[model samples]
Target: MSPTAAPTLRVERSLLRAGHGLVAGVDEVGRGALAGPVSVGVLVVGPHTPAAPRGLRDSKLLTPAAREALVPALRDWAAAWAVGHAEPAEIDALGITAALRLAGRRALAQLAEPPAAVLLDGSHDWLSDPPGQALPGLGEPVLPCAAPPVTTRVKADTTCAAVAGASVLAKTARDALMARRHEEHPHYGWAANKGYGAPEHLAAVAEHGRCSQHRLSWRLPAAALPPAPRGARAADTLQPPVGPGPGRGARGA
Candidate 1:
């Protein structure tokens, strides 16, 4: 597709026509990273116009340059957009699943107008809150009486244009943050790996041990450690059985 060609933006329009005026798409990024925060972005598309760009797809499929290029266009075409994040501490404490929901809730709360309903990328199970438990750091009234229900689906990013837009925003925003972090800790090669547990990253861990930035909970297994050198048995050796006959008789019995 030509750089100038706008990507298709149909998902939100169809919902709008169906009487859902304030439909919003939600997506999160960095769920798999060993470090860094999880970011959730919420976006609402305005009335369909030729000015709206096309070429929407899962953010993973787009390059950094492509995503960067699309960000401004998305902001321009979108009726509204907001991003929320769960910090590394939160991810480490609450886990990725809970972090995702927290980020989503924060993002939605930032929106100027509450959406009639939310289109969350992936399954509804993702948003399952602990029954009657207040959301951490959100204070009392965790589930606002006025908030609308959310809808989620697998591959929602690809099938739903609004979700795709949210993906772009979340991915681009998280990428930028990772890039910034890369400047601070270049030794881990975070810029290239984006905090993923790549082989190089594992090697880095073995060489440097764990850093303050690393999630201590994700330490490499003992097998991942470098192999011991040949003929280097430790002085601590098990003594052989002194009474072999007794052992043999016991075994026979």
Candidate 2:
């Protein structure tokens, strides 16, 4: 397929034909957000999987309204699904790489049953022997692990129904969390940007400084980032909340 088109479940079907009973399509959201935590979503789909709700595509492709409308149906269509998040403190403490592993582990642990294989979006295996650094176009992973095998593909979220489902779930869950947080910190305008680095969000950070929920390790607005230490390598000094998050406070549609 071309680089710009939406995806299908053909890859999931192929894996099913290979005798995989339950392949979980996994995807992540909010990894690039300037605030809030990262979220991972898992959706299990197999040969007998029900059709995804109509008009469901990559969560990034769908409008907030469309994603909101489809959230319940996606939850019902998957045999099993769950969303896991790594709070900003975890992200600051472990850096994004390990934090992602932590989040993915949490999501997988919530599954009703272990997946036969995990169909992860993107070309890098973020959950396998070799973790994906920046999701570079490294093909499938080769290392073995206690967990089920992982199959990574670029644009899997677009081409695989299971992965797409996971994307929607993660996006929806993360958005809900941001909306909830917005109630407490309306200055960030998270209700509109969902914690992304929108202009208003940057302005708020510049004016109000970072919150407990902001990732201290991530680059923030110019005024928010601490000045580089003199004679220190041009790298970060990494260090390490669920409130207003998805555990239970946020309402899902």
Candidate 3:
């Protein structure tokens, strides 16, 4: 693709022309994980025209280095941007869906100006909090915003520039945090899996058990096999059969 192409930004401009100013897109990462925090990112792009950043797509589709490189450019291109996270404890306490909503709300709340409407990258609504309800862990009350009642689409991240921008921000932020977690708990290989349950990660868990960073609510197998013991045989073992009681056996005596 040519560097000058701006298909994503073109879509962003179309939305602006359709009379939606202060349009913010919202997305979350790390929802399907046994460990690590669920992170939400909100990015508001105004009506002003500017060159779109290169290689913008669903954050999952981008490489780590590409996502990291796009983050600062997204921040600079966006009118406003913010990220918020719901840690493992919070996810366990409130559940992933609730935690996701809480994180998205917090991220949007951080914006300097409330958006006119929020475009979410999922079918389920993320902005459905009741009016006057307080955000968990934040002393501040949840302020009413003008986000759409219904989430737009499942693939809004790839289709909408604002959502793509939000995706990049959420993914990059979560990746950085997970990398730090890797330093503290080197066994889980979170730096590599980004908290996704890969085989290596499961092996690490089986060897080390769940760490504080892991969400224990996830129903991982209790008998996860760790690495084989040194010099252990690969063959199966046989057990002796139990004989009947003496008084009851032998044709009733």
Candidate 4:
């Protein structure tokens, strides 16, 4: 069940108190899905705006209809927001970690200006390069960030408004793409399964074989694969979004 007031701006407030004037929240969607590009969302919020509605929760906690309903409200509430995706080919070319970093870079590039700090949704900062081989004298992990300083908060999507907003943005954006993919491959039930390896989707894959949109690197089920029609790729159909959304976090978050 969806809870009331799931996400708060407490993290933003703390950062604001710490002299970070501009703080953006970052979240990603579709990480584990067997198909579709991974998407990242960035949301920059202002302190003066009204508090997000009490029902704003991680996107997974909300229904698809509920999540779609919140996109307009989230756009109205956020100061600035943008979404980015690393397409299926990119995911195969680069590792998921690197592809996520690429998506985040694309998101940050859309921002009007650099944020003073970033509130990443998870404790593990995927935007950063992993620690170099641990040196004997230096016992510290030198994780390198691709963007500004980040304060990684575990479950931030459920506990922080900005992060929740980011989560919603990513979730909605990815869902829309999957919905479009559903149009091309209706048998896969992407509209319902959102390109996840749901029973229906897996069954379709088993029957019709995987398509061009499927991640080639993943240990997919053995099936008679076919090429996705050379129609409009979902990424090509993306239009600039108004702002962002608020509802759930990944798993659709």
The numbered model that scores best in TM-score is 2
Q: Which portions of model 3 show Cα errors greater than 4 Å? A: 1-15, 49-51, 130-151, 222-253
- Residue range 1-253, candidate 1, lDDT tens digits: 4333333555566666777768788888877666677788888865553334565666877777888888998888778898878777666666566667777777777788877777777655444476784457744365422335677776777767678788999988887788898898877788888776777776776677666666544435443345556775743233232211221111100
Estimate the lDDT of model 3.
0.72
lDDT of each model, Cα atoms only? Answer: 0.67, 0.76, 0.72, 0.75
Q: Which stretches of model 1 miss by more than 4 angstroms?
A: 1-11, 46-52, 138-147, 219-253
For residues 1-253, what per-residue lDDT tens digits would candidate 2 score against the true structure?
A: 6544556678888888999998999999887777888899999987788666788788888898988898889888888999988888877765666566667877887777888989988766666535433322113242112348999987787878889889999999999999999999999999999888788887787778889988765654444445557876644543211112222212111
What RMSD does each model have against the real structure? 11.9, 9.3, 12.7, 11.3
The full ranking of all candidates by lDDT, starting with the best, is 2, 4, 3, 1
Assess every candidate by TM-score: 0.76, 0.80, 0.78, 0.79
Runs of candidate 4 with Cα error greater than 4 angstroms are: 1-5, 131-146, 222-253
Candidate 3 per-residue C-alpha lDDT over 125-195 given as tens digits, one digit per residue, 9 for 90 to 100: 75566567444664445442334543466667877788888989998899899999999998888889988
Q: Is candidate 3 or candidate 4 better by TM-score?
A: 4
- Scored by lDDT, the top model is 2
Q: Give the alpha carbon lDDT tens digit for every residue of 1-253 in model 4.
A: 1345578887798897888878888999988887898999888876575688656778877888888888888888887888988877767766566777778777877878767889997767777555772112122253222578888988888888888888888999999999999899899999998887677887797678778888766655423233445895866444332111222122222
Question: Candidate 4, overall lDDT?
Answer: 0.75
Candidate 2 segments whose C-alpha is farther than 4 A from its true place: 2-6, 129-146, 223-253
